[model samples]
Target: MADLWDGALIDAAIWHARTGDVARQFRYRALYAALPVDALEAAHLPLRPDRPGLWRLRRQDYGARDGSSLTDFIRSQLAPVGLSHCQITLVTMPCGLLHGFNPVSFWLARDDAGLRAVLAEVSNTFGESHLYLCRHPDKRVIAPGDRLSGEKLFHVSPFLPREGYYVFRFDPGPGRFGAWVDWFGKDGDLRLQTSMIGKARALTASALRRAALRHAFQPLRVTGLIHWQAVKLLLRGVRYRKKPPQLEIRRSEATAERSDV
Candidate 1:
């Protein structure tokens, strides 16, 4: 497997008419890296932790725990679903000097047959995170546009209530990748929709340099945009819900069996 996969994506979020007729949409060009967990120990990639560079990934940023190897954590997470000896490609933004603020990251696990499962690590601005394990009902391989759902356990956005669920659709490929997630109310109404589409590029120093030059301070920009949008929502009279206590680690929930919106 390649040490890393570098790419760029257009990250967008749309808050549907959940509170009044207010709908807000924002788009930003961002840089992303698909790194294999096993490759973290190898010195084959240009980006490294605590290094001066355009982009870098830190070990403490992800995985089931802060100090554990990501590969081991992923394998443990997949073991419950009977997925063993599978390759995992983590699709996420890198943290450099400016640091990263990823709302979510995808871990695509595949075996000999095809894509087996996906582990989504979701986070909020409040420094809390949750993991949602999404798979087919019969352990079937997931394909592009396949629908997956999970109950809302951890609080993410203050504007969003803690009672709704999330529906996810993914389009993953070697040349490109796309993901869509929609938050639905208890009544099954779409409250918010967010999606990301990106074209893959060969992971190399040159590619990383070009992406950094094009989207300098991409991580900070992502955080800034998030807050700016929240401000806009607050101005629109959207009531903010109090954030609950943080849950550092939680068990993954099975995909919900329900109609797709």
Candidate 2:
């Protein structure tokens, strides 16, 4: 962790563990960008916005995916929930020259008071996405200890069913970033647990360049690891669930839940 930076490179370790009939777990190091949507690019960094570079943030990668203004898209999502005026920050994997894929990305909306809401943008291998808006019932600042629950609407992993709710916890601290997700079945049993935790480094040419070297072809590597884990699960005789129909609506609000963590 380091001093807070409007834009930074997060060096993280992500992990997932299943606690059901078939037990499995995996962890890996990764890199992510904590980007300010309005100030996508800085002259001091090697990254660019909506252009080809060793590392870049393309507007088309998130929100509407139509190369639209990310700020406007985020504003629209927050308006109905009374958070339109909050500042927007996107935490996601930076795209390479050609390919990119993110299992999940976070859109944080904050006011002067503190973090007000978060939009969890989730995607699957089958090419579909969903947005889960998380906020307190009273639209108050979301404390680090608070947990939010939302109905699982999109089919993410074939190993998990669509009939569960996801309990989410986030820590968007100035010096570090962390998020946790637990899948609870309709019967009220926890099926899977996943998390991403990391320290932050200000976005700079030297910092990003070093990170890039450590994670060359990061997007491709991520996709490969996902499939590799899938192969391991299959070998373990885990039953594969079929992909269901696409979710018609893409966004829904999540409710704050009582938590002991």
lDDT of 1 by residue, 1-261 (tens): 222233233233322334324666667666677766555446555555445566666667787548567777888888877885777778888764566778888887777677777888988888878888888868887878677888788898888878768888776665777777777888788777777777666666786677667666777878887889889989988888899876554756646457755
The CA lDDT at 221 in model 1 is 78
Off by over 4 Å in 2: 1-5, 41-46, 258-261
Which candidate ranks first by TM-score, i.e. highest? 2
Residues 1-261 of candidate 2 have per-residue lDDT tens digits of: 553338888888999999877888899988998887767644333566776667767878788999888878999999998999988878999886557889999998898998999999998988789999999979989988888998889899987788878888888888888999898888888989999999988887788878767666898889999999999889988889999998798998788684532
Worst 10 residues of 1 by lDDT: 1-10
Highest-lDDT candidate:
2
For model 1, name the residue pairs that clash: none
Quote the RMSD, in angstroms, for model 2: 2.0
